[model samples]
Target: MHRVGLTGGIAAGKSTVAARLRRLGAAVIDHDVLAREVVAPGSSGLEAVAEAFGQEVVTVLGELDRAALGAQVFADPMARERLNAIVHPLVTEAAREREAAAVADGSTVVVHDIPLLVETGQAGHFDELVVVDAPPELRVQRLVASRGLTETQAWDRLAAQADDEARIAVADVVLDGSGAVSELEDQVDALWAVWADRHPAGSAR
Candidate 1:
C-alpha cells in the first residue's frame, strides 16, 4: 500500500485534495474525524480527557464540551499539550485499525488526512508526504471571510499549528492551494492518474 500523509494548514484546501483523491480510489483516514470519535462520550478517551482537563470539559448529556475545551487549549499551550497527550495516542490506534481495514480491502493508496502531520512527527511514517501549500495570510483571510472567525481567532489557530516551512521541508509532494477549486482538483487528478497506473486494480471504477 502507498501510505500517503496529507496535510496543510487551516483553510489550505487540504479537504479538497483529499476528497478528490477519495473519488479517484484512495481510502482516506481523516484524523480530525478520528479525533472526535476517540473522545466520544462514553469512551476511555473521553475519560482520559476529563481526568486531565477536568469534568467541566464534558457536558451534562455526556458529550464533550468542545467549545469549552477549545477555549482552554487555544489560550494555554500547556492545556493544549495536555489535550494532545490524551487524544493523540487514541487517534493513532484508531487510525491504524482503519488503515489495516483499508489494506485488507485491497486499497493500493491509503491517505491519512492529518492536519498536524508534521507537528506530530509523522513525516517519516508515510511513503509519501503531500502538503497542500497556501500562504498563511491567504488562509487567515479565508478563515475570517468564510468561517466567521474573527481575525484574532484565525491568527491564533494558525499560530497553534505547524509552520509552513516545517511542513514544506519534509514534503515529498506539494499541491498548490492558492488557486481555484477546479485547479486543485486538476492537480489531484494528475496525482491519481499516476497512483492508478501503479496498481490498476486499486481503481475499482
Candidate 2:
C-alpha cells in the first residue's frame, strides 16, 4: 500500500484535500478524529491528561473540556509538549492499526491526515508527504472569520505550529490552498492519478 502523510497548518484547507482524496477512492485515516477518540471519556488518554493537567480540564459529564485545556496548553510550550506526550503515542498506535487494516484489505493507498506531521517529526515515515499550504496571513484571516479567534489568538495558534518553509521542506507534493476550492480539488485529483499509477486501487500486497 502507498502510505501518504497529509498535513498543513490550521485553516490551510487540508481537510478539503483529504475529503477530496476520499471521494477519489483513497483510504483516509483522520488523525484528528483518532486524537479525539483516544481522549474520550473513560479513556486512559483522558485519565492521563487529567493527571497531568488536573481535573479542571475535565467536564462534569466526564468528558475532556477541550477549550479549557487548549487555553492552558496553547499559551505554554511545555504544557503543550506534556499534553502531546500523553496523547501522541495513543494516536500513533491507533493510526498504525488502521493503516494495517487497510493494507490487509488490499487498499491501494492510505492517506494519513495529520495536522502536525511536521511538528511531530513524522514526515519521513510516509512513502510520500503532501502538505496543503496557504499564506500565514490568509490562514490567520480564515481562523478569525471561521473560528471566532481574536487576531492575537489566531497568530498565537499559527506560531504554535511549524512554519510553511519547514512543512514544505518535507513535502513531496505541496497543494496550494490559497486559491479557489476547485484548484485544490484539481490538485487532489492529480495526486490520486499518480498514486493509482504507483499502486493501482485494490491491489495492495
Candidate 3:
C-alpha cells in the first residue's frame, strides 16, 4: 500500500486531515489510538510502562494515569526518554502489524496518523510524508478551544514539539489546516489523487 506518514504538532489538525483521507477511501491507522490500545489495562505494554515509570504512574484500575505521566515526561527530558524507550518499540511493532494487515486487505493508500513522526525520527517509514500545518499561535488556540487545555498548557504542548519550520522541511506534502474543513478536504482529495495514480493496486512500499 502507499503508506503515507501524516503528522503535525498538537492541535494542528492531523486527525482532521486523516479523517478526510479516510472518507476519500484512504485506510488510516491512527498512532494515538494504537498507542492507547497497546497500553490497555492488562496489556504487557502497561506492565512495561509501570516498570519504567514506577507503580505510582499506574492507576487503581490497572491503567496508566496518562495525565500524571504526561506531566512527568513533559517536564523532565530524561523521564520522557525513559518513557519513550518503553513505549516507542511497542508502538512501532503494532504499527507494522497494522500496516501489513492493511496492505494485505488491498488498501490503496494507508495513512499513518502519527503525532510524533518528526520528533521520533520516523519520517523514513513511509513512501511519503504529509504534514498538517498551522502557525503555533493558531495551534494553541485550537488546542484550548477543542481540548479544554488552558493557554499555558496548550503552549507547553506545542513548545515540546519540533518547530513548524522543521516539520515543514521534512514534508513531501503540506496541508494547510488553518481554514474550514472543506478547504482541508480539498487538499486531502488532491493528495489522494496522486496516491491513487501511484499505487493503483495497493502495492506501494
Candidate 4:
C-alpha cells in the first residue's frame, strides 16, 4: 500500500484536503479522531493525562476536558511536550492498526491525516508527504474568524508547531491552502491521481 502523510499548519485547510481524499476513495486514517479515541473516558490515555496534568482536565461526565487541557499545554512548551509524550505513542499505534486493517481489506492507498507529522519527525515514515500550506496571517485570520481564538492565541498556536519553511523542506507535494475550497479540491484531485497511479487497486505493492 502507498502510505501518504497529509499535514499543514493550524487552520490551513488540511481537513478540506483530507475530506476530498476520502471522497475520492483513499482509506484516510484521521489521527485527530484517533487522538480523541485514545483518551476516552475509560482509556489508559485519560488516566495518564490525569496523572500528569491533574484531575481538573477531566470532565464531570468522565470525558477529557480538551479545552481545559489545551489551555495548560498551549501556553507552556514543556507542558505541551509532556502531553505529546503521553499521547503521541497511543495515537501512532492506533493509526498503525487502522492502516494495517485498511491494507488487509485491499486498500491500495492509505492516507494518514496527521496535523503534527512534521513536529513528530514522522515525515520519513510516509511514502510521500503532502503539506497543505497557507500564509501565517491567513491562518491566523481563519482561526480568529472560525474558531473564535484571539489574535495572541492564534499566534501562539502557530508558534507551537513547525514553521512553513520547515514543513516544506520535507514535503513531496505542497498544496496551496490560501485559496477557495474549489481550488484546494482541484489540488487534491491532482494528488489523488498521482497516488492512484503509483498504487493502483489490485496491483502488487
Candidate 5:
C-alpha cells in the first residue's frame, strides 16, 4: 500500500483534506478516531488515564471528560507529555493494526489522518507526508469562529501541538489551507491524482 501520513495543527484543515482524499478513493485511517477508540470506556487506555490523572477526568457515564483533561494538560507541558506517553503508543498500535487490515482488504492508497504525526514521531512510517499548511493566527481564528473556543483557548490548543515549522520540515507535500475551502479541496484533488498515478489500484506493490 502507498501509506500516506496527513497532518496539520488544530483548525488547519487536515480533516478536510482527508475527507477529499476519501472521496478520491484513498482508504483513510483517521487517528483521532482511533485515539478515541483506544480510550473508549472500559478500555485499558481509559483506565491508565484515570490512574494517572484521577477519575475527575472521566465522566460519570464512564467516558472521558475531554474538556476537563484539556484544561489540565493544555496549559502544562509536562502534563501534556504524560498524556501523550499514555495515549500515543496505544493509538500507534491500533493504527498499525487498522493499516494491516486495509492492506489485506486490497487498499492501494492508505492515508492516515493523524493530527500529531510529527509530535508522535510517526512521519517516517509513511511513504508520503502531507502537511496542510496554514498560519497559526489563521487557524486560531478558525477555531474561535467555528469551534467556539475563546481566542486564548484556541491558542492554547495550538500551543499543545507541534509548531508549523516542525510539521513543514518533515512534509513531503504541503497543501495550502489558508484559502477558501474549495481551493484547499482542489489542492488535495491535485495531490490525490499524482498519488493515484503512482499507486494504481489492484496492482501488487
Candidate 6:
C-alpha cells in the first residue's frame, strides 16, 4: 500500500480533506481517532497516562478528561512533552496496526491523517506527505471560531507549530485550504486521480 501522510497546522482543515478522501474510497486512518482509542477507558494506554499525570486526568466514568488534561499540558512545555511521550508512541503503534490491516485487506492507498507529522519528524516514513496549506492568520481565525480558543490561546498554539514555509517545504502535495471548500474539493479530486494513476488497481482511491 502507498502510505500517504496527510498533515496540516491546527485548524487548517485537515479533517475536512481527510473526510473527502474517505468519501472518494481511500482507506484513511485518522490519527486523532486512534489517539482517542489508544487511551480509551480501560486500555493500557489510559493506565500509563493516569500513572504519568495522576488520576486527575481521568474522568469519574474512567475516560480521559481531555479538557482538564489539555489545560494542564498546553501551558507547560514540559508537561506537554511528558504527555506526548506517553501518548504518541501508543498512537503511532495503533496507527501502524490499522495500516497493516488495511494493507492486508488489499488497500492500494492508505492515508494517515496526522496533525503532528512534521513536529514529530515522522514524515520520512510515508511515501508521500500532503500538507493542507493556509495562512497563519486564517489558521488562527479558524481555531478561534471552531475550537473556541481565545486569540492569545490560538497564537500560543500556532507558535508551537513549525512555520508554514517549513511545512510546505516538505510537502509532496500541497492542498490549499485557504480558499473555499469547493477549492479544497478540487485539490482532493485531482490528488485522487494522481494516486490512482500512480498506484493503479492496488490502491483503494
The model with the greatest lDDT is 4
lDDT of 4: 0.92
- 1-205 in candidate 3: lDDT tens per residue? 4678999878777888988888777788988888898888999999998888888889998888999789888867788878777777898899889888987877768888998889899988789999998888998888889889999988878877888898999999999988888888888888777777776764232
Q: lDDT of each model, Cα atoms only?
A: 0.92, 0.91, 0.84, 0.92, 0.89, 0.88
Q: What does the lDDT read for residue 196 in candidate 2?
A: 68
Identify the runs in model 4 with alpha carbons over 4 angstroms from their true place.
202-205
Residue 39 error for model 1, in Å? Answer: 0.5
TM-score each candidate.
0.96, 0.96, 0.93, 0.96, 0.96, 0.94
What ordering of candidates by lDDT runs from best to worst? 4, 1, 2, 5, 6, 3
Off by over 4 Å in 3: 201-205
Task: State, as a TM-score between 0 and 1, how close model 5 is to the true structure.
Answer: 0.96
Error of 1 at 115 (Å): 0.5
In candidate 4, how many Å is residue 103 off? 1.0
Task: Give me the displacement of residue 128 in model 5, in angstroms.
Answer: 0.6
Q: Give one digit per residue, the lDDT tens place, for model 2 in 1-205.
A: 6788999999999999999988877789999999999999999999999999999999999999999999998889999999988899999999999998987877778899999899888989999999999999999999999999999999999988988999999899999999999999998888787776776653333
lDDT tens digits by residue: candidate 6, 129-165: 9999888899999889988999999998887777788
Task: Give the CA lDDT, 0 to 100, for residue 77 in model 3.
Answer: 73
Error of 1 at 97 (Å): 0.6
Candidate 2 Cα deviation (angstroms), residue 115: 0.5
Worst 10 residues of 4 by lDDT: 196-205
Cα deviation of 150, candidate 5, in Å? 0.7
lDDT of 5 by residue, 29-148 (tens): 998999899899999999999999999999999999999898899999999999999999999899889889988887888889998889988889988899998999999999989999
Better of 3 and 5 by TM-score: 5
Give candidate 1's error at residue 24 in angstroms.
Answer: 0.5
Evaluation by TM-score, superior candidate among 3 and 4: 4
Of the pair 1 and 5, which is ahead by lDDT?
Answer: 1
Higher-lDDT candidate among 1 and 6? Answer: 1
